[model samples]
Target: MLSMVRRPNPVQWLRYAAGGRLPDHLREWVLRDVTTRTWFLRGAARSSLLVLPLSSVWLLLPGPLGLRLSLCLMALLVGYFYSLAYLEESCEHKLVKHGYRYGSGRATRNAAKDALEAEAHARYVARYRN
Candidate 1:
């Protein structure tokens, strides 16, 4: 029997984190993995969205580095924050044994969602900037 708890499935989670748009055609293709089917680790691509930027920053830092290392560290911090914010947004719904609750009449939940979205955008830009 299926539990009443409707946990965030992989596609829904990634789509939520992507802010209602797939990052690219390749990413859209990967979303098909969300369906239960033959698979080798679903959601890997979406998880990489959370990883590649930080890994790039780490690899790009100058050796015996100057301000570049500091900059990369700062970039990592921003990525950390963006991940936290997105996680919070993706889990904002409170699942009770019976049903679910969102926002819950609290101004803070919506405030947090907005703040996280903005932070996610900022982090994306910082990571992708040439």
Candidate 2:
């Protein structure tokens, strides 16, 4: 179980973002197997960096409207990024909704490996047997 007060550090968070589980400092949040492709894709989708450049579009408006629009866009960007970044601490209860649960990274990887190995072993047995 995760501590109510203690939060995962940046390094641990990086592990999570990389589609791995948090270190021992944090418990497993994901229950099912997850592939790196899915992990990276989700992280990329959650990224707020896209708005940084898009917000600049307001700057090209050429008047006070541009200034106001730019400020608004910047503000929106900040709020968006803030929410996305802090989702971990404030996000525990909601992880299930996204189909991720905190769990041991090693365990997950081992499970995948075991599954693959089992499949391979089965194939070998079938091919060599009379």
Candidate 3:
């Protein structure tokens, strides 16, 4: 099923990062993106593209090289910390932009997690409660 879903090309992804929408054909791919196991990592990577350029400007400030580098690292860390704080909301917004309901992305992820927990409990019951 996933094999049939087409990924966005680099240009399309850049547009996506800039808040543009993809075509409807990529809707399933969008859902998978927001619900996958690596969704948090993917969100961090996406946010880094926006954060990196801004942080890099600190390197151009007039100062000792070590001081400039330290400021750049501080800015990068702060940017990433804020990005992580809102990561789930950011992913949900992506799903909403892709035409899904507001909370559907989180719902889908929770459903997958619940299924795994249920399967684990079933295995425990079968082994110990029989």
> Best by TM-score, which number?
3
lDDT ranking, best first: 3, 2, 1
Between candidates 2 and 3, the one scoring higher on lDDT is 3
| lDDT top scorer | 3
lDDT per residue (tens digit) for residues 1-130 in model 1: 2243244557856664454543343332322323223222333444457655665676565576666667676776676556555543333332211133553323444565678899999999999984
* Local accuracy of candidate 2 as per-residue lDDT tens digits, 22-74: 54433333322133225434444434444445566666666798576868677
Q: Where in model 1 is the C-alpha error above 4 Å?
A: 1-3, 21-55, 65-69, 79-130
lDDT of 3 by residue, 1-130 (tens): 8789899999988877666788899889889987998999888878888899999998888989999999999999999999989989988898999889999999999999999999999999999999
Preferred candidate (lDDT higher): 1 or 2: 2
Each model's backbone clash number: 0, 7, 0
How do all models score by TM-score? 0.30, 0.30, 0.92
Collision count of model 1: 0
> What's the true lDDT of residue 83 in model 2?
52
Error of 2 at 121 (Å): 2.3
Clashing pairs in 2: 28-102, 28-103, 29-101, 29-102, 29-103, 30-101, 30-102
> What lDDT does candidate 1 reach at residue 53?
69
